[model samples]
Target chain A: MSGASRQPNGSHAGGVPHDDDGVPGPGEMGGIPRGPEAPAPRPPVIHALRDAGLAALVAAGLFVPLVGLRTDVGPAGGGLILRTRWADVAILVALVFTGRLAMNLWSAFRPAKRPRTALRAAQLTRIGTFVAPLFLGFAVLMPLLPWTTRYGLDLGVLVLTYVMLGWGLNIVVGLAGLLDLGYVAFYAVGAYTYALLSTTYGLSFWICLPLAGIFAAFAGVLLGFPVLRLRGDYLAIVTLAFGEIIRVVLLNWVSLTGGPNGISGIPRPSFFGLSFSAGGEPGSFADFFGLEPSPTHRAVFLYYLILVLALLTNWVTIRLRRQPLGRAWEALREDEIACRALGINVTNTKLTAFAIGAMFGGFAGAFFATRQAFVSPESFTFIESAIILAIVVLGGLGSQLGVAIAALVLIGGFEAFRDFEEYRMLVFGAAMVVIMVWRPRGLVSTRRPSVALGERKAISGDLVGEGHG
Target chain B: MSAPILPARNAPILQVRELLMRFGGLTAVNRVSFDAMAGDITAVIGPNGAGKTTVFNLITGFYKPSGGEIVLNGPGGPKPLHATVGHRIAQAGVARTFQNIRLFPGMTVLENLLVAQHNTLQAATFFGIGAAFGLGRYRQAEREAVALARRWLEATRLLDRADDPAGALPYGAQRRLEIARAMCTNPVLLCLDEPAAGLNPRESEELAELIQLIRAQGCSILLIEHDMGVVMRISDRVVVLDHGVKIADGTPAEVRADERVIAAYLGEGDEDDVPAAPVEGAA
Candidate 1:
């Protein structure tokens, strides 16, 4: 009412408008105006995507091959021009351009609809769109195509596993705003849980999956207790140490984990009774089912399995965010002092975030072990945690869709460039630096902060509140 | 106004018995004792660094007392109120606002009030998964929170800006929102630190009316304010602190006329020389 009437143009009451440098200044931007209705500024995404598009075009030109080159495929009777190297280079350029274009379109259109529904649909569609290509390329198209298709499908599966891992980490780092550097510890817990359970009990992957999540949740609580009082960089260091400790335990504890040699011959997931292997019964899946027995079937199934798990993770995360616990986490992140004032048990809030986040990590880890049919300390390294954290950060902290988009670009795009092994990490690192410089908050930086109660209408003079919890 | 809702014969709602707080060699609150009745406006007044805020902090569990006890007369009568930290104190029925408005800068005004009721919301049933789908008793708690927030928003005349960030509200509105947020917990005793610190005279008078309204609702108030006009206008009783010691405790007129209280303010040579105007720079 009276307060609303006193609000500055495009500025919330008590909120001083800042220049590009973030300094508050006096002007129409900071002065109280005499009006009943003043339109709020457009959301930040539109501006970000426009800037990203211009940068993408300039980067695309750098990927053009120096010499127009070609290779021949002997399998086809005719000379099939092999532009593998140029195509590989061109794909990166194309990805950047596509990512920019997609971001621009998303930003421009996002504000036209209800933010909550649009956000949910955008999240699902983004994941769905990326996943549709995998099912088509791996399951249906690969078998009909050539050997090159098989290789591409295998690489896609591998990239997807990491993407899932990154997504799980995103729930912790992105949504909860907890800096977890030892996320791989949960991954190790899941892998080991499955490996030990399947080998010792002779249980199937399906049965071990839920158990792994529970065990990892237990482990997360264990880690959370000691670091309850810690915050910021200290918490990060302790979590990093915890990750290393898990790796060291796996490596040195030979009796349980098989130590340095690592656990081998880990069983892959089976469909009901059928297994993907040679020398099965005469009328097995290949004969009785009337389908060709190929390793690709296992790869395709695993890809879809992880894909579903990833979707579940996203769904669960979105839902949890609307809950009281989610708000508590954001509140804690904003100000522990105020959170305590609200009678929120900060210790318990943090533990829940850790436990839930780790549980998802465990699910991904179990899937990883079954897919690869192997378990090793090498897979659960600090670098893995770093990459997952990077995905969360690059996507944007506290933004679920942002993390997924980040993973798709970073993990998917990086793996797609496997042929250029030496330059791959260099390119990834450079891209990260460039992204950080351009958009310090990350690519998809707009956050739909966890609102206490339900989402309310945007009142005049107020920009969207950040959810510290 | 309405008749004061006095506590039952034998016990005060909150009784601080010889509470003492020390910072190394420096004694912040020295043997301060007070009682807040069930429904009364008890104003705590003091010169700068006179341990008024420190006493509030000690009572609200922001700081542990170096000595003495804080007892909230529960159903059992004179039960020790565990003043462990800020959060536990809030759980124990004591809510407070900072001298500097400390609303979650990123959170909306309505959310600021809702967060104050966080502990009252039931936990997630069905292994925390049910919360994701928004299926739970939390819906009822949410309704209560919204209704309470709306009531305070209307009371503060901030209903139109309910969805705005608390930090985005005007300075006076921010001050009122802080009180609204504290009230959402349905606190037995509201501890407000310098609620009138930076308000204009008109806003201060409005704040005084709001405090009286809050008291009329059966809530006991412990306020630290520098505004003499507001203090005299609303406070039923006043406690004056000087150099970590209670210099005077009586009705507002009695404390105002106390020579010791007047000397404590005027005798503090350099402090009195400084401008008596409100400090307006934002935190």
Candidate 2:
């Protein structure tokens, strides 16, 4: 859109697309009120050629220094000398020129996309309905594969952890329409809760897990109080501040959090009081079950633990959508003023959304602490919150299955390209830009009503409110 | 004794006394006062920007009055609506429609109705947790809620499209759905702002019938309308406001004849012959 806007107005002619306000005839667009779908007056094939040529020229100019030339050490002890690689520059320019030309022509000639409607959205979601169960089944059985490696199990646990976090934040951002940039704060709370309890009080992970969620929920309520009246960007800014506040507090609160050094050697969760040691101790998991000793046992157990937790989050979220409170949250998102007229306590609804979302974050945090046996303020940064938010938004806000898939792709994608760590952010950024351009609403953008008296239909994404809150 | 279906007819449902609202230097509604009796349609007729909606806002608790009070005479007796907050006004048995339609557009039509009765289910579900666990009691409450929603959907003629998103409903249907959604809150007083604004004559006639039907159900109607044809025919009583002042309050016929009310309308509408609409058995 920005590129389209930047072009000289008359240059668009008939070939360029405008927003579909009713279709306008071709020649009227240059001067009259223009729509993106205005009919082409002329072929504009010449304009396309000019635009593509110009783009290629710019690409060549940029590539001349960036790719066409390289510097090498001149002799062992001396300065550098220039090496020309015009072949590389020519290939890059040719690719850019053709790519730009193809994109321009495709966009120009393509029929206008159909307006989203409930029936169409329902048809799109039918595909997801079929695919989701198959994906869930695959996830459940993947750990049981005969060639499953310990690294693979750990990666599964990691991806599942993000999936849980994404599901939790979905309640706040997607369902309630509250954009929370501070979700990772709750995760930090849960991790620190387990870390401090297990390291200080010698409490088991089982006991500390619930406490972590409770504490995080408590923190959620605390954050919810002063910001109850804020909405939209104001709400987002406050939540962002809240996230930074938690991180800074942890960084400075030396006596309790150990400052920047971080707490380590946090105890791993036991399998119902059975340790995972290979010492053949009586309480060891292998000893109790009379199985051969292998460290894979602990990894597999951790994988299953997080898997169960993630599934529980998904299940509870699905159930809550049918509940009155959940419906109110959605209503509030659609129109807060209307919610007020309908006699919904906006304060209570927003608070519950925050608290519940934070509780899940806390649960995930405890899992993180137990798995890594380490806790640090550095682990709970704004980046973690951004990544989690990206997953929710990219997954189509409230879509449960979409969130799971997005989490898997994002977290697994990050780990899979570990060899190219330097370019990881670059690839991620490009992917985000491409996703935003292609599908602004998200990958799966249908919203199924929590309860329906008639046959259920998926509401089109355009109808759903991007909650001001 | 066989009971009358209407509850306590002719009792005062809403009373406004010296209702005032000010935005900065402008006094939107100044010293407006009126009473709507139960089982009656009270149409508030006024010129544009004459503070009709300002008065409705004060009564619905959307805006805190600069001065004066609005009261709803609930079954429990007169409760001060002006003192309560927004949702509290609805909880106190007062509900309103926006001048611009404000439905939960993303939700299905049935879901919009269900949201209107949120207070009941919220309590039944123990504020959201019990229902999450599939509690037994909430399921029954939910069934009752759905039944109630279906009844209203049937009333509004939206039953066939219950599963469609509210945003997709035709404009006239959306207006009817807004009224239905408001009634789902079970308010004694329903305040409608310009309910028939964009309706064609046929649709407006249907709206008049719906309003009367609502009145027959024993709920008081407080309406702000620009369509004089619908206003004069359906309202049992009409209160005229011009520039934030009530110029006349009486039966629709009386108010129509009042010279002051006619002058306020700037003689735009011939006040005398609106009643020819819905003439029975006319050839």
* TM-score versus the correct structure, for each prediction: 0.77, 0.88
Q: Please report how far candidate 2 places residue A52 from its true position, in Å.
A: 2.6
lDDT of 2 by residue, B179-277 (tens): 999999888888998888776677788889999888777788999887778887889899999888889999988987788877777374765543332
TM-score of 2: 0.88
10 residues in a row with least lDDT, candidate 1 chain B: B1-10
Clashing pairs in 1: A12-A461, A174-A398, A319-B132, A329-A469, A330-A468, A330-A469, A331-A469, A466-B106
Candidate 1 docking DockQ: 0.31
Clashes of each: 8, 6
CAPRI-style quality class for the chain A–B interface of candidate 2: acceptable
Candidate 2: stretches off by over 4 Å = A1-40, A53-96, A108-126, B1-7, B272-283
What is model 2's native contact fraction?
0.78
**Candidate 1 lDDT for residue A402:** 64
DockQ for all candidate structures vs. native: 0.31, 0.38
- Candidate 1 per-residue lDDT, tens place, B107-178, comes to 677777777777766343343555556664666656766787889888887877766666666788888888
Q: For candidate 2, what is the DockQ? A: 0.38
> For candidate 1 chain A, which ten residues in a row score worst on lDDT?
A1-10
Q: Considering every candidate listed, which one attains the maximal lDDT?
A: 2
Model 2 per-residue lDDT tens digits across residues A215-317:
9999999999989999899999999999999999999999999999889999988998899986767889999999988888889899899999998988888
